[model samples]
Target: MTLSNLNGVPGREDAVREYVQQQLGGLVDDLRVDALGNLIAFRAGRDAPNGKVKERVMLSAHMDEIGFLVRYIDERGFLRLQPLGGFDPRNLFARNVTVQTRGGTLPGVLTPGGRPIHISNPEDRSKVPELRAFFVDLGLDAAAVRQQVRVGDMVTLDQQARRMGDLVVGKALDDRASVFMQLEVLRQLTGPPRHDLYAVFSTQEEVGLRGAVTAAYSVQPTIGIGLDVTLAVDTPGVEADEAVTRMGEGIGIKVYDSSMISTRWLVDEFVDLAEQAGVAYQLEVLSQGGTDGAAIQGSRSGVPTLTLSLPTRYIHSVTEAVHVSDLEAGVALLLAYLK
Candidate 1:
């Protein structure tokens, strides 16, 4: 929940990195931040066979969420934005947002510049506004706004994580939930893993797999595992077949997505491990979307890679939700594989 609440957008991940670093104290043998702001932590293998080199395993979860930057501030104090990642315009209506400037954060309201429904024509009401039509209102005079805010300051949606029945609902859970799972796996380690682990809290994943691309090149892991959230569109309006994975059913073992297919052998291995350990898991095939696994798998001569996905609903929106049992199952499966 803390991880989800921290604000970090593409190319701006300091707050999230700092929090993760604090949580990792003494849990890892070595830790460092890369040039691209990816937080890399290493734990040496303890159970490697005598006279045999240990395999390097890379586990990555991104810290950045989809957000916007202050692109143009008008004379009247209305701030225009440049979006950083994919956003559904329908969800951007009248949202509470925070503008992080050099001095401090400012509260604001995000809405498209248009007439309200009461004053709007039928045609205007029927049309959804484009992303560029949106602006932030700070409720301050132009002079006051320009004195504080800048063109490149970060702007993020506001939402606090909360428990809803068996689910955890909050903003930025697309990957933060996976980040939490990775942290839990580290805390649960009683001894060194079977393989050398390189846990990477990556950045700029919402824009592209930018951080993972460089980190994978540096680590050059023999095996790669991406921690991310997958779609769980099991709502009333969606078809059953379109539901990639169902909430509370289990964690997802990725089989296919547009970015990269899971390495066949690695997928089989994880499935076998899950079955042996009695950990609930679902095989996922998403028609679109990608994760850090694609970047790692495509690095160098291509290391084998698979992504462990948490079932999530309403991804890319503030209400992104993940099932608690699914998160536990992910941690369990990871421990079984690494131990």
Candidate 2:
């Protein structure tokens, strides 16, 4: 929940990184932040044959969330934004937001630049606004706004994560939940892993997997595992077939997505491991979207990769939810594999 609440957009992940670093202290043998702000932590493998080389396994979960940068501030103290990642405009209506400026954070309201429904024409009310039509109201005079806010300051939606029945709902869970799972796996390790682990808390994944691309190149892992959230559209409106994975059923072992197909052997291995360990698991095939796994898989000559996905609902929106049982299953499966 703390990971989800921390504000970190594509190129700005300092707060999230700092928090993760603090949690990871003494858990791993080595830790460093890369040039692109990806936090890499290394833990060596247990005893192996003197001449044998242990495989390097990279586990990546991004820290950044979809947000906006202050693009243009108008004379009336209204601020225009440039979105850093994918955002459904419908979710942007009258949202509480925070503008992180050089001096400090400012509270603001994010709304479209248009008339309210009471006075809007039927045609106007029927139309959905584009991202360009949105603006932030800082409730400050132009001079005061200009004195604090800048063109490139970060702006993030505000939402505190909370437990709802069997699910945890909040903003930024698309990948933060996975980040939390990775940290738990680290904490639960009873001994050195079977393979050398390079846990990467990546940045800029919401934009284009930018941080993972460079980190993968640097680490050059022999095997890669991406920890991310997958769509769980098992709501009332969506078809059963379209529900990529259902909440509380299990963690997803990715089989296919638009970015990259899971390495066949790795997928089979995890499946077998899950079955042997009696961990609930499901096969996922998403029609669209990608994760850091794609970047690591295609890194050099191509290392084998598979993603472990937590089924999530309402991704890219403030009310993103993940089942607690599913999170437990994911951690258990990863621990079983690493052991």
Candidate 3:
């Protein structure tokens, strides 16, 4: 919940780093913030053959989420924004948001530059606004807002994490759910890992897999696992075949995505591990989107990599949802493989 609240757009991940370090500082062998703002934590393995660590395994979950960056503040105290990542524009209508300023957080509402429905013609009422048409109303005078808010301040959706029966719903759960899963894996891991472990809370993935590329090159691990969220389009009006994953089914062992295909050997190894461990698992092949594993796999001379995704509904929106059981299964499978 704390992680999901932080404003971690592409270049704005300081709050996430601070929160991660504070929570995980004492648990790992070494913790450091890299030049690209990736938080790297190491845990030495004690179960190596010949008492020497043979392989280094990297685990990554991006900390950044889709957000808006303040661009132009008009004289009317309305704030214009440039998106830091993808937004549907349909979700930008009269939504509550928080602007992270140097002085303090300011509350605001996002509204598209359009006529009110009551005052609009039929043609105007049917037209959807473009991304550029959106602006934030801070409810303050132009001069007062200028004094407190600056250009490049990140604006994130105002939504609190909540449990809804079998699911958890919130904004920024696209990756923070995985971030929390990583932290839980760290806490619940019982014995020393078989390979030296590098758990990296990566930055700037919502923009592109930027931090993952840099961190993967620096670590140069033999194996990498990218933790992320995948579409769970199982709701009404969507066909079963079109649904990439079903919520509460199990952990997703990704086979392919638009970015990268899983290493065949690595996929086989994970399947074997899941079967042996008696963990519920699913084979995922996302036809459209990508994850940090693509960057990790393409780094240096290239490393074997795959992603484990949590099935999420309404991605890139304020009301994203994830099944608690599926989340736990993802953590369990990854933890077992790491062990």
Candidate 4:
């Protein structure tokens, strides 16, 4: 429950920025909100590395989550949505939602148009609706909804973070879990860092890594570490080889994904450090996803970059799950590496 549950779309990350800043308090040497809504926190090291000028180390985690924005309100008070990030149409059905309006937040139910089981034919029962076919029912008159909600208002899944056994599940776990890791690391951190540390809660990462692209250019770090969630298809129906990572295994030292390949030396160094620190870890090669590391790797003249991924299941859905032991292992590895 300590994890932040605020709603943030790709381009709109103001609330998330504020929440991170509030959590940081006076722990950081400098904290600022960038033009692109990235929350950049600086922590200076005590001594330069090997007597040379210290290099900056960038640790990034995106704060944005997949959600929808209101595009139109029909005459019957049904809200049409434009997705802000990738979504599987099959998972979005009869979901409770919160519409963030200018006036106030409104409760609604997201339901795709389809025949009920009682009156449905065999084809209707088996049919799957497209993402565009879904509508939000606010149970209000069209005129009243129009007066309160604007076209660009955000809508997020209505769910609370919960603990089940050793696993935590809820909406927005994709990046918020990483955010919580950053927060816990900052809290337990004691002395100066080895390099100038910049913890960036980047925005618009779900859309196209927009915030990280700009933040990396501005920071021009010597090392970039992307902290995000990776696929954990350790459940039923998934092939053993296709399970990129397994839940509760440990932290994932990402080697390659769709966006970028990790710097080999850095990957090796992290593996060595994890062994030295006795932290549980796994090497991951995601087949089809990218993280902030790609943006940082492509930044001005490039930087040595890698990703530390937390294995997560059911990503981009309300029921995303992450293991507590894996989360702790990720924090332990990060702390060890920073030391």
Clashing pairs in 1: none
Distance (Å) between predicted and true CA of 101, model 1? Answer: 0.4
**Global Cα lDDT for candidate 2:** 0.96
Compared to the true structure, candidate 1 yields what TM-score?
0.99
Please, what are the lDDT tens digits per residue for candidate 4 over residues 42-136? Answer: 98976864758777999999999999999988888799999988999888888999999888789999988877789999988788888888999
Model 1: weakest 10-residue lDDT segment is 45-54
Residue-level lDDT of model 2, residues 230-327, one tens digit each, is 99999998889999999999999999999989999999999999999999999999999999999999999999999999999999999999999999
| Pick by TM-score: 1 or 4, better one | 1
lDDT of 1 by residue, 157-195 (tens): 999999999999998998999999999999997789999
> Model 3, residue 229: what's the lDDT?
96
Which regions of candidate 4 fall more than 4 Å away from where they truly are?
2-4, 49-53
Off by over 4 Å in 3: 50-53
What is candidate 4's TM-score against the reference? 0.97
